[model samples]
Target chain A: MIPYLACVLLFLIGLYVVISKRNLIKIVIGFSLIEYAVNLFFALVGFKKGALAPIITQPEQVRMGVARNFVDPVPQALVLTAIVIGLSTTALMLSLAMRLYEKYKTFDISEIRRLKG
Target chain B: MEGRILPLFVAIPLAGAFLVPLLSKLWTRFADLIASITSALLLGVSVYGWLMVNAGGMPLHYWVGGWRIIGIAMWFDALTALIVLIINIVGFCASVYSIRYLDRYTGGRWKFFTLLLLLIAGLNGLAISGDLFNMFVFIEISAIASYALVAFGTEEEEVEAAFKYMVLGEVGGAVLLFGIALIYARASTLNLAHLSQVLAGFGRTPFYWFVIATLLIGFAIKMGMEPFHAWLADAHFSAPAPISAMLSGVFIKVTGVYAMSRLMFNVFGVSRAETPAFFNLLIAFGAVSMVLGGLLAYTQNDYKRLLAYSSISQIGYILVALGIGNFWGIAGALFHILAHALGKGTLFLASGSVERQTGTRNLEQLKGLEKTMPATTWSHILASFSMAGLPPFAGFFSKLFIIIGAIAARMYWLAFLAALFSAVTLGYLTKVVNMAFFVKQNSSVTSTREAPGLMVLAMLVLVVLTVAVGVGFRGVLDHLVGPAARVLLNGLEYARLVLGG
Candidate 1:
């Protein structure tokens, strides 16, 4: 319960940074932070306190109803996929920021406001 | 049902995406030929799929690797067919336009085609995926490609706009994933069919409402709803014209509106008797988007920016129809989706042509183009009439259906406001025509030719579609829109079909 709340807090902090920060790199970091928090929360949802690995290498454990004590592996797989997507997108965002810096000579987002909203 | 054809939608585009770059290295013109051929092929496949489904064989599902519940599932129902038709037909036109239209941009054409194919692959995947997590990954694929496409110019404004769009899009994606995580934790499954069955008995508790709200907000931001639309105008204005057309035409509908409508009506059962508030929320959002988008669009000087805001307004009409949640309402929503895709797609392509010829999108700078660019001007005239809900155009019938749907639902004020905004759309568009065409040629203007033959051909195809859909809407309504709406109206039936009941 506490870990879930902490994950939500992390997500909120990232949201705040994205909303309040002016630096382009900081904004990208904020997005990464949100991704990590969601990934963490997802993993937490599938975690069991005293669970064994989901693998079934032994016949004995299979007979002992080991599936009951096995942690959910699907969330871990999902988290891995999410992390890779996050990494690639963050890389793209950073490269775009580098180009923006080249064109505008600044990292501050407020200074990069050529297209009016 | 022809189950095998489902995967071809994703595979063909993915193959084309990679093949274009490799082929481009060997021959320069092959990229154009291959990209056009690929989109045309996808268009053919989508039409064939629609014909197959319309012939009484539908709700076909395929399990990847034959893994049943363990592997990802893809389904091609009426709703999927409708969206696939929209994506591919518009995609085909955009690809055709881009072949010649891209000569103005500095980016490599091969890279553009590759990214475009990847985006189409993602959209096709999203439209057909039977699982929630698979949808998220597809959304990411399309989002990433679009982010890069937005910054394809590498100009300062383009980069800035792309960054802004990316930041908001990422947040929306995260929130969307969070909602999916919550749903997964509650149901202990990721398959949308399985989850729908589980959620059927779960009832509308506080957690369910929370999940619905989260998903709604996430997709709203993605679709550029009125309150969350800060990034839309900027991104649309900054991207190249073909990309702009794609963004405004199909991207918002596929990723945002269609996804949200499917989830709310099917997976979550928002159309159930207990969920009056859900419909009310949609109505409220629709009202806001309609009024605000129209009012704001009336003030824009940039041609593409104005169209982007009009997209938001037009989307509001579709949402209001969907929110009504009646037969005609759902059908109207579907019709509006197709109508807007053709009308706005043509308009944006024409705007791209105008920008290409004049080298500026500013209304103040571009004047009397009808004399020089007749094809573009006529295309503009047709699109504007359709967009403004004028008689005998495609936009008119769709908007009329929405108004009638609202009236049938006894939402008199909503119907009236929808009519009023149709006028607002006309008023602002008249300003566009007045300044860009009717006014005398500007002093700095030079002789301009029609947009390249292929570009004009693409725009003409959409214009013809706009007219054909308007005149032949009775056949369209009976065959396509009716079935798609039935899919939404019979949400529980979807669960039953997918779960083999």
Candidate 2:
């Protein structure tokens, strides 16, 4: 329960930073924070108390409730994909930030003022 | 339903994206050859898929690796077929246009073909894939490609718009991912078909409604609907012209509209009977976008930016039709998707041709083009007429159907607004026609060149489609959009069709 609330809090915090920050790099950091919060939520959703890793050594383990004891791997798999996407987008964001710096000579988004309407 | 053809919608483009860079290294023409062939093949497959769906065996399911529940499912029905067809047709035209369109750009022009193919693959997968998480992956795939393409010029403004687009788009993606996570946690199934079946028994609690709202807001940003539309005009105006066409034509439709419709209707079984608030909200949002977008479009000096706003307005029409929540309403929405795709594709490609020829997008500067670029001018005029809801053009039929739909739903004022906006649409569009084409300030500009052969041909193809679909709208609505709209109308039956049959 606490972790879930924390996830929501972190998401809100990241969104706040993204909206409020003027520095382009800080905005990218906010993006990464938002992604991490979602990934954490997905990870938390899959976690179970005393759950075993989802590896079956033999068929008899299924009858012994090993499957029940196993944490749901689906969300973990989903988070893996989400994290990779997050990384790629963050990398692209940082690179674009770099290019923005080269062109505008500032890390401040407020200063880079070319595109309007 | 035929099972073998589902993967080819994605495979051909993905393979083409892989092969184009290699082939371009050998010879630049090979890149064009391969990209056009790939998109042509995709268009062919989409048509074939439509035929198969139309033949009555539908809600086709292809189980990946033959795994029933765990492996990803590729689902297709009338809705999927329609969206896929739009994606491919626009893709084919854009690839053909790109052949001549890339002549002005320097530095590894072959890279553009690769990104374009990648974008198509992303759209194709987004439309066809049944797993919600996989759809997110495809969203990223196409979206990242678009981000790069939007910044392809790497000029100061292009990179800035691309960065802005990426930030907003990635945030929307995160929100969507969060929603998908909540859904997966509750439903325990990622397959949309199976989730629909399972969710049939669940009560609509606040949590359920929250999930719906999150998904709605996420896609709203993607589609650039109303309040969340800040990134659209910037991104559309900043991208190169052909890329602009693809972005405005089908990307938002597939990413935002198609995805939202699929989830809300098929998976969640949203209905006017049950979710009046949701449908009403959709209607309200649509109306706001229609009026506001039209007004904003009228104010823009850049022709592409104006077209971008007009895209928003047209998207509003589709949403309002969807909100009508009746057969004609949904059918109209489906029809408008195609109509706007053709109409907007021609207009944007024409803008590209003009930009290429005169090297300017300012309406004030472009003068007396009707004589110089006759093919482009006529095609642009015809497309603008269609967009302005003139008769014997596809836009008129779509607008007519939507007005009929609103009347059928007893929403008289909404119906009136629909008609009124047609004139408002014409009012702003003619500003472009008059300022850009009819202003006879220069005989010297008449000495300027026409667009190269293929670019004009591309615009002609879309213009022809607009006229053809308009003239043959009855057959179109009956054969294609009717089934697609029915799938949305009988939303829960989608589950039965997919899981039972």
Candidate 2, residues B207-303, lDDT tens digits: the string is: 8899999999999989999998888998999898888899999999999999999999989999988888888998999999999999999998788
Name the regions of candidate 1 deviating beyond 4 angstroms.
A56-68, B441-443
Give candidate 1's error at residue B390 in angstroms.
Answer: 1.7
Clashing pairs in 2: none
lDDT of 1 by residue, B39-157 (tens): 99999999998998889656668888888887898988989998999899889999999998888976588989999988899999999998999999998999999999998888888
Docking class of 1: high
Candidate 1 chain B: minimum summed lDDT over ten consecutive residues — where? B438-447
